[model samples]
Target: MKRFMLTWVLFILCAGTANLSLAQSTVYTPATDLTLVGKVLPTQQVYHRVDTADHPDMPPAVKRLLTNSAGLAVAFKTNSTTISAKWCTSPRTTLSNMTAIAYEGLDLYIKKDGRWQFAGVGRPNGDCTEYTLVRNMAEGEKECLLYLPLYDETTSLEIGVAAGATLQPLNDPFQKRILMYGSSILQGASASRPGMAYPARMSRAAGLNFLNLGLSGSAKMEKAVADMITTIPADAFVLDCVPNSSPDEIRERTAYLVNTIRQHHPKAPIIVIPSTVRENGAFDQEVGKRVQAQNEQIKQEVAKLQRSGVKDLYLLSYPRQLGEDHEGTVDGSHPNDLGFDRMLQQLQPQLLKILRKCDLAGR
Candidate 1:
């Protein structure tokens, strides 16, 4: 009886060892093998450009916003249906019930019948150092777009596929891009998942690349940030910072921001979006007045720019921009997925018009 018991224990231990070995055998391909979009470098130190010598050190605010890997994505093609990833994220936490995956998750999409479709998402396991994004993908070669994290800093990232599967760069033909600068909503606050962020959704819908320069509460139309913006070539520039600015600040700074961008991009369309109507504004008279005043000031400024020969300038109003229901937002201010979808619905038609006017489509 003792000998039989010992043999049973040995068999259990061997089985466990074999299972571990099999799991370890799965191999990963570095995401760098394909194309890392929206960044000059695969391992960029900061999401936005900074003059290190001028500042020498990153300001706490800049560091905080720049580290959030918003608007970055990896594009590739593979024959294997099963896709996976391993990534490390910087230490951070949020009060919102947003999952670690949405805050620090990897979102996957595939081009099907000439349209980008949602595939699957990988959830991080409690500040996990490494996590598998997806596995057992459908077999056959297909183009894929993988969106990076929305609110967390990605320290390292890699893509994995079943061994012996073909992985190559996705030769996307859409080259025209829209560069967006805004506040927390643009930074994807309270988004259920990374790809659900409006800009990502817009990119797939409009067939254009999007460069997100959302700075949380700090998108105050700073001149220094505009200076950085002058460097990237884009088809259109979307300024959506009304939520972070007061009426006075909008009046004082909006012209300079518009002029600065105009100096660099002489003909590219520039869309100035006023703050969206917040949910609480329906009941909070003070909040409603403040938002209305800011929107009016921005409209006046944009009109002035147009009269001053700022060609291709446009203004998107605030009223009913996110829908009248007021159910789109997660809080009174930040949007949930529903809010984002509503924003997208409103923005898409205007964006398509701008793209056509600029002759940026199919180029």
Candidate 2:
């Protein structure tokens, strides 16, 4: 009798395993129907730069830095009940306090009625190549947008839908583009998810396209970088690189960066944002003073630009933009999801106003 009971348990376990395998075997269709927005070209896998020597406009150093696909996204409308991602990254880990999801995960959003809503996230596998973003989604057709990894440099990526699902490009009417240049925080540092980053949030809230050129601790407002920014045609520009620059650097380079971009885009709105107050500034006087000095220099440069008759120029400042409670950052330096939300709340309104101004100018 005991032997019979053991045999029955084994049979049940085997059947359960078979059922699980069957449940996991959903066929995926190639996501070729989606419109690859945000990128410069259909053949270009990287978003912000061209191959070295291929373009006469940007310096080679700037081109090399642009290889990191920080702000690229794919937009589509689909009737699939399931979604998947097959992607590979050059580096699986960023070696920071930030998680792999913030660096390499695929962030998915759905358009309902007229607004974009966060749908789900696709976590990377152990090798950082394969991910099943969402399986068995709700039925019916919906517009979808998938944001690529913010920090991780993707080597190859592809979206997948359930077999025989209806898929096409999303017909979004908002065409104004906002270009952002800044440091690691703008590059999506310690945010728990990609969509939680301020740029992504602002993009959805304002219904505008954004090109993020945030280099981790490297955005020094260099002339080469400024030249690269000029190559892109955008409706508005946001400069937030004070955290990565010294007071001296800010004083020296801020004016030049503004002037260079203005030379290329005379009428585009340029918004200068000072650095967010760092978390440790309260206890560390030196850090506090350094940040303050940088901010002061930025203000001086913006004032200088305005004095010189640079139109469509604006400045945004908040003493405690991230938050006063010190609960907004992952570390003492980089913003967490809460910090990003706080930033979005403060910045989105100004962005909307800028977009409206651009619309009027266009008309």
Candidate 3:
């Protein structure tokens, strides 16, 4: 009788193990298998901003940052009731003002009713993490846009689906690639998630291809970097480097960057944006004065470009873009999600108007 009971218990334990294995089983599709948007150069299989090997002239800072997947996204469709992902991230330290999910996690969006809505997010557990993004819903075909990590390298990414669910590439839904180049704010620092970055937010809001070329502290408009950006054709360009550059650097490199770009893209619209008001500037007198100086210098530079027969060029700045309350930034340097949203609200419509005038956007 005792032997019989022991055999029964063993059988139950084996059954439970088998069930657990089946539950954990999922078929994953590599991100490369899906349509990729928000990329300026698709010259490599790896998800990098630019192929550093090709552009040996690129600044060391740019090359170091090229591997960080800032604005890359996978556009795909799946009929799975449960969606999951497995991604390997590069080694990086934790950001004090940024969430691990925002710096190195995946944000998923689903198209419903002709609009993109937040579906879910995959939180990182380690260097290689797998998390369920969305689950237990009505099973139907859904289009998905998965934004990659903003501040870390996505070494490899694959979208997981329950076995037998069909996954297919989604055609690019956005139009007119718009290149946004600037600092850490543009790189998505301090946002809650990858999709909250201003460029990513603007991309969804305007339904336009906004590629992020944010070089953190390196967007000094170096001639090498300028040459690299001009090599790629864009319908419009957003220069937001004032906050990262010194007054002298801006005076020296701003025109050279614009003129070189004009030589390549004579007709593409160039939109220059001044620095946002730093919250600390209110307390620190030098900070306030420097921001004011930068603001004046950018206006002067844009005016000079416009006067030099630089057609289709404009400087875009709004009163209190970060809100007058000074509650927008995460660290007084980088924008939090609210800071980004305020910046987007002011920049998008004005930008769309200019793009429409240039006939790059739908009127």
Query: Predictions ranked by TM-score, top down?
Result: 3, 1, 2
Candidate 3 versus the native: TM-score? 0.93
lDDT of 1 by residue, 27-49 (tens): 66777677767652223354333
Give the Cα error of residue 237 in candidate 2, in Å. 1.1
Model 2 has how many clashing residue pairs?
0
lDDT of 3 at 293: 90
Q: TM-scores for all candidates?
A: 0.88, 0.86, 0.93
Q: Which pairs, if any, clash in model 1? A: 81-137, 81-138, 82-137
Query: Cα RMSD for candidate 3?
Result: 4.3
lDDT of 3 at 190: 78
Better of 1 and 3 by lDDT: 3
lDDT string for model 2 (114-223, tens) is: 88888888787654555667767789998888887777767766776666787677764246677888888887887777776677777776667766777778888877
Would you list the C-alpha lDDT of every candidate in the order shown?
0.76, 0.74, 0.87
Error of 1 at 327 (Å): 0.7
